[model samples]
Target: MYILYIFRFFIQKEEGMSCCSFLDLTEADLNLMELNMDRTEFVVQEDGSLISECNDDPNASQRIRVRSDIQERRNTQSMTGTNKVPLHMFSRFGTVRATLLHRVAEGQALVLAANGSFTENNRRALMRILISELIKVHGSCYPPDEAKVALAQAIVTEFPLLRNTRTKKGYEHYYDEETRRGFIEYRLWNVRRTLSPSQKKYKTKALDSGKTTPVSPNINLLSQEELDSKIAWMKCTNPSDSNKQNIATHLQETLQNRRDWIIKKSPNISQILHEYPRLLDYNGEMINNEFRYFFKEKSVNFLARFPSYYCPRILEYAKLNRLDVYNRLKNITDVNLRALFILADLLRINNAMLAQQGDKGKGKMKGKKRQRSSEEAEMIEKEKIDVPSTFLVRFAGTPLPQSIQEASATGSIIIPPYIVCTQEENGRNSYFVQGDGWLIKPRNNNPVTAFDLLFKVYFALKICYPAGLQIFYNFIESYVYDLGTKARGVVTSLHVNLSNLKLDKIASEEFIFGS
Candidate 1:
């Protein structure tokens, strides 16, 4: 089905060398990250499987011990011109772009079904709404230049028949934030048509019709003459009459909001972008948490798209939990609520996908398949793939084992080492730690509310503290609350933590401004 995963551990060593061994004794005096290193032995075959013994020499012992160690690290400050990879490969590497786009596209069916006049301006508005959503979900994946350029191009050309309308002429009048200029319509169409595959079909259709020129979209609800008549009728001879003023005011408001399947004017695509999109926001107003939670529980369409190749949570709880969550969300086929919930759920899932990327080339385990030696004699075929020992741990809002509960309760910093707990076996005590890795626990039980979580998230932004990782810890804490909220309300750890933290006013303003 579907689930979320976060990848923090991957390699115990780089280039067959233990990463922990190079740690100088002074490592203890350094970052909190460097001090915590307990190596775990994971078995890997030549095929990089944790399960298979199939090697060049079947008898050869090649169970590799991999130990991943996090070194003292901080966010490196970047100058104004620091270079990140270009945007073309965004979908290939991360789930952010793909996930966001999928949610935006959810409203396409209803949007296309809109009986409102199919003006070029209207379609452009839809495209702007699409781009706006893309910004919210995957803003960090691409630079502003790419998004702005792509938005301008995509908005204009998504439905090219609208290119010549009077509305289209106004497209360039509004300033775009990224380009620092109004959207230039002409070049965007050329560039987009050049890159898009739909170009071929469009050309063929033009030829099949044997038309001297492209056809114009027939707009029926309102015409230039009708609009001018209406305007004149509103500015009547009874200018001083309150009834006339009221009629004119109502007419203007109606015209501003009216979307007919036949009219031909639109303000700017962005003007109506927020109101129409059903997935993320409704005309700039965010969907209420009530409807969001209601539908998210009822569908998992968002989860099924999770990158299973990297998301261990999808694979780990493939049958038990995550799949069910995804299925539940997906089952909700309502276009409106479903679209919004899917967006929120996808955001949650994609966060896990990004986390998994950090685990690449790290501590991995191999699976083994049985191999048959063939000669003149017939041999039986058998195979087994080695499953990687490295697991993508999901710090979701699920209850933890008793061991984790105890560890979480003592929320204090101490000597960094793998805490070996004593497990009783046949009346004898044996000491062992799971492995060299971190054990994640929720901070409380009421699944962290979006408000509290968002506050913590952007708080660091206002404080100018590097906080790409604030979400990770906040989520863990939220899950803790989710798991425990029902059993213990006030005494739960998350609520206590929430009560203790005093947020300053500047933090609130920064959140408002999104700086």
Candidate 2:
């Protein structure tokens, strides 16, 4: 007896009707079917034979199965079609541009404007179209860095005028590699905000997994009762007192407890200030004390080396490297301006060194493998350095209204601990520690001191170093602070630069002694 096993395959609809097809199962097909047992209903006998039950009316049973499979396929298609954007309709830019022009002009003759720049409305519409097409390929609103870079490159290639010449990479205005804040990122953020709760949860989890957790200090000397009492007293004390001796004493007494609380609880800036009001003291003694607590003797090393050691070496290095910024700032007489320029040059040099290393690695691979390896290396570099979490904003005038305004305009989030250096009307610079919509003016007027405090605050508070300046901060943490010698996450380029600087220092010392 020949037992025919009926299988229904749902094919594409023909003339608005579902088409059901059947295929003869060869031994190979049966093997494939065996691998995918979950998709089909089949019984395996004790002898290891596969069979499907048949009704008395085999033809009727087959017809019912065919109709059910076709209906199921139609339901699946309809559900997915409803969720998907009709990307095929406007995937081609020529078709989209023509359609947009026709609709906007209402079949009238439209002339090109002189500047050829898009208006706000036109830009929004264009971004929407581009994002839709991106989603079609990516299946998510968050496209990878490579995809974003490719899209930005394509845009600039097509429209050369849109290129931003000020940035190193002209396409940075569309998608900046360092800051990760550009037109595309802004649009993606907005899109993510509007996504369904389920989608947002998954995306949020993925993002949170990569975030660097703040490092808390291990010191917790005071008892819970003593800590609570000290916190209560500090909360009631005036932060702007002329004689801050009592407040400073209390702050010193509870330093370890405060750090432990801040690290373990992870309170916001507002809450932290509320508990320890002395953190907002005008002289910045409390802030300095916290730094001393964390680094001890190394706390003074930055101030000692910054002026006498680091500045001179950085300038010498910049000149040797023949950096363009060196020539520009070489003639600057102002101490602060010259120092700032040198720091900027150092960052540029570090970036170049890193890029050169990546390039050398990419040169080893060939053909299709070269392209894949290059992309993977780029992704690895991106992952190794997180996006900038802190910003250094400088402006003319005081920190209260002017510097804060400048920081906000530059898109820097002012949520405590970011450094702000303001040039007052008296030709003097004032360094302020911004804290949750408030400012703490440090007694020091030097920009370099402000940076030292900034780095210490990040360490004491367990904040991540800003990504763009990670190499610079790493050098400071290891060489200056004398901390985290064996810790992971120190970039290899940093060690090479440090070794070179050390050799230069030793050579200079020997020359002076011999002379």
Candidate 3:
């Protein structure tokens, strides 16, 4: 029998995700289900810890009858959330963290800390994690900055007495060896940032209702500035005492575990949102657009490639350690999921590089494969297009304001239509999917740059893909139409006569002037 397990993770924001996680286990996976409720078979203590011993009456702290019928139904239902996640996605890091985050946000986080691995960073990280989960469940406001700050304020206001701030002199103030005793003015960072009407309303609703959701601010702990200070101090002073190291190490582990747990447990956390719904709807559009600019042009040094439609989606999978992918690939299993958290921890180990290297078209450098069954790929591909017109995007007409920065590159891209041009036979067998789709390489392996994809598209599936899947059709159609615009930009015929090497580099870097 196939065992169905529903799970979650901790996604990080800035990347706009949470860091907690969970899992669903099918009845077949649970061996204890058949055991009839024999109270004498169990034991529990005052602290509610079940003692493992068979006595005349095994002490049970709390015994509530679990309906086997309800448990069976819970096992079979489809797990629902935003982000259109396929069930097969799995990440070692994602699974654990998602489970934790989901539990904590719902006020059911388990006590998994082992003797002092809980650092202040870990604690704040866990707290923030709960808040992110709330963001997902409640649907956070648009213009996240104002909404986020407003949320922070609501949280701050909840515990007026717990607020604390940094000194006016700053952290370096305490750096002086001799004058460490002077009274330093402390500056409190009151969570008074911008707030959208809806976010303010949500925070107010939660605060006034006397019910705290996950995203609600933590007024009880040190502020972000203070936490950073603590982290910084922890980093700066290498306590000679071995016990202090052990203590710091413990706190660090606890916090890391906490972060991982939350990230993996949450079902709704969307990671690396470069493009979805509206074209560049969130602030992440700029980096994504930059990638478009970087890859659209042909370059000699770079491999021939075009953008795949799933760039943002793939990025989410990568950073989020998509459980669907992990679960599907039995070969990889959950080993790599743990790898990411270990990776996060590994980063703390000094000069550790988590980047997996590969040879071109041979390894991950060749690329990673999508783990979904062909059926799933078809379903995802069938996803409705919510994007605006690409040609009409008119980057010149609108420039992103300076402050916003996106997370890592989604690395996947949406290739425009392949222009059907008759060419000499470079053929063996047809390499195109469906015998007539965009020729861009799949995201399963080493990422194909948009430049590399364009060439592949030129040779294969030479036709415009219709709307919804028009990313392919758009590229070739737009370029042919804009040929004159390219010609106009070329100042001199001699400049155009440059070698293929130089032309390719220039083209890849610039949007205009390329084959």
| Top lDDT prediction, candidate number | 2
Provide the overall lDDT of each model, using Cα atoms, as 2-decimal numbers: 0.28, 0.51, 0.26
Tens digits of per-residue lDDT for model 3, 1-515 = 22422221122334432111111433553354443333323222333222333332343334433333333333323322333323222211133245343455432332232111222233334344434433333243221333233333332233222122222222212121233221010011111135545435334321121211232234244445654554455444444444354434433433332223233332111221111111112222222333234344532223221221122222233233335433443332223222222222211211111111111111111111111112212322334222222211112234222111110122222223321212237722111111112122222212123223333332221122222222222322223222221111111111111110111122232221121
lDDT of 1 at 321: 24
Deviating ranges (above 4 Å) for candidate 1: 1-343, 351-515
Q: Model 3 Cα displacement at 233 (Å)?
A: 70
Q: Best by TM-score, which number?
A: 2
Worst 10 residues of 1 by lDDT: 372-381
The stretch of ten residues in a row with the least summed lDDT in candidate 2 is 364-373
- Model 3 residue 258 lDDT? 25
Candidate 1 is scored at a TM of: 0.18
For each candidate, what TM-score against the reference?
A: 0.18, 0.43, 0.18
lDDT of 1: 0.28
Query: After superposing candidate 3, which stretches have Cα over 4 Å from the reference?
Result: 1-147, 150-321, 326-451, 455-515
Q: What would the TM-score be for candidate 3 when compared with the true structure?
A: 0.18
